[model samples]
Target: MSSSNSQKEILTLIRDVSTEKSQGERRVVNLKRQIEELQSELESVNAELEDAKRLKECTEQDLKGCEVELAMNESSIQTLEGRIALLQGEVSTIGSDLEALKVSEDICFVAGGFRFMCMLIKCLCFEIAWTCWFINLCEHAFRMKNGLCDDFIGKMFDLNAMIRKFHQSVDSASYEAFSSKAVLQNVHTENAHTKQVEEGKKDLERELAQIISDTEKMEHEFLLEQNLHKQVRSSP
Candidate 1:
């Protein structure tokens, strides 16, 4: 009976060793599967990170472009402001010149001045008319060249044009008023010059008549002296 129990014990030890080896094989297989799963998850995460990096670079480039556009817009605004200031200065200078022209009412000619007055008035009218037409053309050209037909651009031009038109109208009215005043003064000067010329012509005619009368009187006195000498010689 003791020999039989030892053999049974040895058989039980062999069976237990076979079962543990089988469980160890299953654990190794599970570990390998888990490693493969972890490796796949790591690869997926790395791919996602690379895609995010590419998106970040694209976003940065877009932002840089936006900044550049903003800078360009700011520079354009500054240039427009400078142009407006220069235009204002030009308007002011034109206004002053118009005022000076309005105040200059002195007549330049005094004697024999009818033809002269006609010529002067003709020249002044021609110059003023030409200047007004030229200014109108210049304003129109500026509007066209500056894109002033657009609604937004037209707004700037409208403000400037309105101011210019208002001042120009005032100046034109002043010029007209001065012209009226000058007309009366010029007429008076011309009349005075005409009267003086007529009087001088009459004086010249009177002097010529007196010289002819004196010469006729001298010829009559010499003829009377010659007749007295002839009578004296006949008596001898």
Candidate 2:
């Protein structure tokens, strides 16, 4: 009886040991599966971090490029502004010069017209003096031919005076005509200069307009780039 009891106790102890060993093996397998899952998650997180770092570097490069472009645009804007100011000043100067030219042209026209009128009057006076001299000479010749007893010496003196008067009238007429011509030429010169100044003003205006257009385009591009940079900075 004592031997049988001891064998039974030993068998019970062996069964308990076997059951504990099986439970321990199952727990170890579960822990190994958890470790593999955690390792996979760590590798995925590391890849995402590398991608984020590369993206940050690219974003920094883009920001630097944008800054450079913005600075260039600003410089261009300043240059255009200066050009616009210079053009405006030139236009104002041209306008003033044009006004002066117009006034001068008007004065020249008035003077030329007056000179032409004076020339016409002087020519008419010359014709009248010549007609009077011819009539007097013809009368004297008729009297002499018919022996009318006219004072021949006095008649000769009168004819000489008339001839001298006719010569003076002719001189005056020629001088008036010459003066009129010179004044007309001056008027033409002034008109041509005015036309040239106007053409220059127009060219300046066109250049100013083109510069303004270019500035507007650059400003728009700058705004777009600035907004893109802001978005990039705000991104996660």
lDDT of each: 0.59, 0.67
Off by over 4 Å in 2: 106-236
Q: 1-236, model 2: which lDDT tens digit per residue?
A: 99999999999999998899999999899999999999999999999999999999999998898778667756765665676566667656656664665545343444444555666687678778867876887787776754544666576678779767866766675575456445555556566444544554465566656656665665566566566656655755
The pairs that clash in candidate 2 are: none
Off by over 4 Å in 1: 97-236
| Top TM-score hit | 2
TM-score of 1: 0.39
Task: Estimate the TM-score of every prediction.
Answer: 0.39, 0.48
Candidate 1, residues 1-236, lDDT tens digits: the string is: 99999999999999999999999999999999999999999999999999999999988897786567556545554554555455555545545544553343332122224334444575567567767865775677666744544654555567567557655755564554445444545564466544544544454455545545554554555455455545544642
Worst 10 residues of 2 by lDDT: 105-114
